[model samples]
Target: MDMGRYLFRQVRGSDAAAIYELAVANEYHSDNLPLNRSLIKAYVQRSVKDFAIISSSGVCKNPLYMFVLEDTYTRTVVGVSQIKNILWRLLYQLRLDPFLGENIGKLALKKEDGTWELGGLLLSKEVRGGKLGKLLSYGRLAYLMSKGLAPRMLISGFLKNTFWEYIAIRIGVSKEYNPDKHWRSFKTLTKFMGLLPAHILLAETGIAFGYFEDLFKIPIPIKPESEPARKLLVDMGLCFLKEIEANGILWHGAPWKVIRDDNFMRYKVPQDTIEVDTCKTSCHLDIGMAVLPSDDFRAQYIPVAKLEDGRVYISKKDFSCGKPKHLFIFETKNV
Candidate 1:
């Protein structure tokens, strides 16, 4: 899927400066990100190193990719998403198997097996409410699936939100949750409040309240209202399990979602049916972006070329530019 106006590419060392600008913009919404210029530079460097050779092999194995979306016309870096092929070591150390056994039903995410984490997705507001998001999501899967590198399972953590709640209802995740399980299992309050003195906490509630009044104000285990999680569920067969994981947080208190890889084959759009010369139907649309009548053909990415047969398409060759070499495209609207 080509993002009509924007092209997605792996981050290069040179992209650090531009990505930093984008990162800082997201920093304004503290929940979105908190990267300073230096961390942003290191992030780009890590991404470049992680995917340097394997990404182009049509499969990225034992991989990680930090993708940057560039405005084809403006040439500015506008959006980004990150994917990692393996779950990090920290999850095991956190000791959350009981949570998974109790809340996640039959599925389990293991450290040794191939599991991929999809996150670090940020799209500029201009591209937020449309197909751009889906292209980035499905395109990665398309790439992974094609290379036979698709994980045995998929996992992601998100800030709890109305969209997550909606996904829960739509996918049969129960809402009969204690909700306090988040705070009890995670110990979020004690960890964050560790900044304050022990004596202040050991004192009477009255004294503790007086000494650290502000800390008590914020609610723990923030419920997230994510529209994006719904799109992920559709494209990747993911569901919001009640279990919250510490691998990543949407803000400070996001929950995790998981599903088996077999679900991808079960749920994927049958791309083999669509006949568009320049497009593959496997590229899914955003949640609710689908038109009612199946015959309707709305353009997601207007191809750079319409063949003599009137087939509209943008091929992998077209996405190559100086800054963006190997690519995927995602845009809010026709450019």
Candidate 2:
């Protein structure tokens, strides 16, 4: 169980086949997206490009990084964890429209005021016994902290289950179940119905239960056995933010003093590092607080700053003046 034998590194194009095979084998549990060779290839390519940009620009704000746990003996990837720049993309593409599209961005903007989300933690079935999950989870957070992007608050969503909730409670991140909670009642009703045979439930409600079931199939069952992992997360300081039916999301925050502590400062900023690439040309000034430059654009890491006029400025080294392009300012924070 020497975890050090498995190192984390940016995934490469050559890894497409291995990743695709892994995804295909685990599709029944992990991803519902259609399994196709072409699509998988495209995903790998996009991920590679994204890692390149983040590595080159020294930007840690984007959740586009895919760190793989490699088996040194076999030279294979055994586990993967992901952080996202934006969490609502999958929800949006599905057209499920949980909340209005505009509101989604607004909510993210609001959340960014003090928090960031940590999600998409998955590991191969073979690698489940050790403390690899914990290591990977903390590793991602550590990476974020190094970029000066650690958010005060960190959040994660979990499907409803006693095991997971118990874990959250143990970590002091979740509250004891309260019958008065609105979401609790909703979840109880949903689970009750979910227990019935699918056809029976569909017949009773006259709702296309299969469609919804297929669409939102729970990859992992909410069993009591998974409480250990849940407890571990809560202990690390995450709490329940909101719950939808049988699902709930949690939040955690690092104390202000802890964030400014000397140990944290040294852990976050690196002294020796590669120089960041700068813009090749001058850019036009825009009437915006910050610009949401495309991930394709080449730019240096810019610290976010507040202006005297009550506007925020994402300090960029150069304003690309070539095209009369408009850039939307995206909220910046580390997850």
Cα misplacement distance, residue 47 of candidate 2 (Å): 3.3
Model 2 agreement with the true structure over 39-90: per-residue lDDT tens digits: 6567567767766766576544544555566676799877655554542311
Error of 2 at 56 (Å): 2.4
Cα lDDT of candidate 1 equals 0.43
The candidate that achieves the highest TM-score relative to the unseen native structure: 1
Q: How close is candidate 2 to the true structure, as a TM-score?
A: 0.46
Question: On residues 239-331, what C-alpha lDDT tens digit does candidate 1 reach at each position?
Answer: 433333332232111112233244434433332322223334334232211111111111124333222453224334332221121122322
RMSDs, each prediction? 13.3, 17.5
TM-score of 1: 0.53
> Model 2, stretches more than 4 Å misplaced?
27-43, 58-62, 87-115, 159-221, 224-226, 245-335
